[model samples]
Target: MKRWMQHIMPPGTKCMCIVAIVVHLDFQSRGIGTALVREGTNQADQDEVLCWVQSSEAGRRCFENEGFEEKERLEVDLDKFARGLEGLEERDAERKWGTHVWKYMVKFPRQVD
Candidate 1:
């Protein structure tokens, strides 16, 4: 196990996962999200880690700007997911985050000398 970890992990890297990345609604359209993600990727670069994120459209834009690449995309039909919700029509479902999924992405940041 120790040998396995050493071989797979770079010098300073460890197991790291970013389950969620959200900037405040008030901070939207600003560069806050990009900065946050850039910092995260920068750290990953130093640690020799490859970072992953499941990003929505806007979130996708942020990561993409920072050089993340899409590995996969998943879309959910809310009508199927919601089944029998009284007020959520298929069209209405389009308007909610509850109906969508991210394109899986990974980022490899440049190593600083």
Candidate 2:
């Protein structure tokens, strides 16, 4: 967690990090990802803890829709990792390997009345 996150989650506040959520290709765009995030948020709310996740591009929207806000981002170049690997030339041509972005997002527990 970054120092600024202290403002969102005061010192000693309990926190939870959701590492990953993956939906099958055939099942995507059907709200499954949103449902998963909702479940996590619900649990965090019940426990009164802040919830967070490092989300890929595909998962960013789901997390956002679940009330998570982007706090930080990390970008990695795929081409650098794939360098000197055979057969990547053709694949690179097809997709144009580029930077992959990961966003660190957080959602504070909803306040109770």
Candidate 3:
């Protein structure tokens, strides 16, 4: 759960640290991932910032359980992405990708003082 600080600074604000947590696949569903996220969030203190991630349904469920909500979404029409492509052209990439999931989601802490 090492957080990589990219030092992205907005106007009149402190730099933010982008957290990229890596939990082992073998340890899935054993609370390891949840624990890692909790520990990572515990590191934040008095910094006006944001944290985001791109995840699956299962991952989204986990984040939701931790009080995350869908703030933004982009419906990528695979047809547009493959409009002029050769192989797999006619196929609707959105349908192929299962309900057109969003690759990025942003979330903030529920507890704010």
Number of the top candidate by TM-score?
2
> Where does model 3 exceed 4 Å of error?
1-24, 45-48, 78-99, 109-113
Answer with 1 or 3, whichever has the higher lDDT. Answer: 1
- Candidate 2 residues lying further than 4 Å off, grouped into runs, are 1-11, 85-96
lDDT of 1: 0.72
| Displacement of the residue 80 alpha carbon in candidate 1, Å | 0.7
Write down the RMSD of candidate 1 (Cα, Å).
Answer: 6.0
Per-residue C-alpha lDDT of model 2 across residues 6-94, encoded as one tens digit per residue: 64677788998898798999999999989988988998998889998888988888999999999888899887777565466664675
In order of appearance, the predictions have TM-scores of: 0.70, 0.78, 0.52
lDDT of each: 0.72, 0.83, 0.51
lDDT of 3 at 83: 38
Two-way TM-score contest, 2 vs 3, winner: 2
Winner on lDDT between 2 and 3 is 2
In candidate 2, where is summed lDDT lowest over 10 consecutive residues?
83-92
Per-residue alpha-carbon lDDT of model 3 for 1-113, expressed as tens digits?
12222322234543323345556789778887777665544444334345556555557776665545665554565545543443554454544433456534544544447
Task: Tell me the RMSD of model 2 versus the true structure.
Answer: 3.6
Residues 18-88, candidate 1: write the lDDT tens digits: 56778889878889888888888888888877777767876888888888888777788655555556576
Clashing pairs for model 2 are: none
- Candidate 1 vs candidate 3: which has greater TM-score? 1
> What are the root-mean-square deviations of the candidates from the true structure over C-alphas?
6.0, 3.6, 6.6
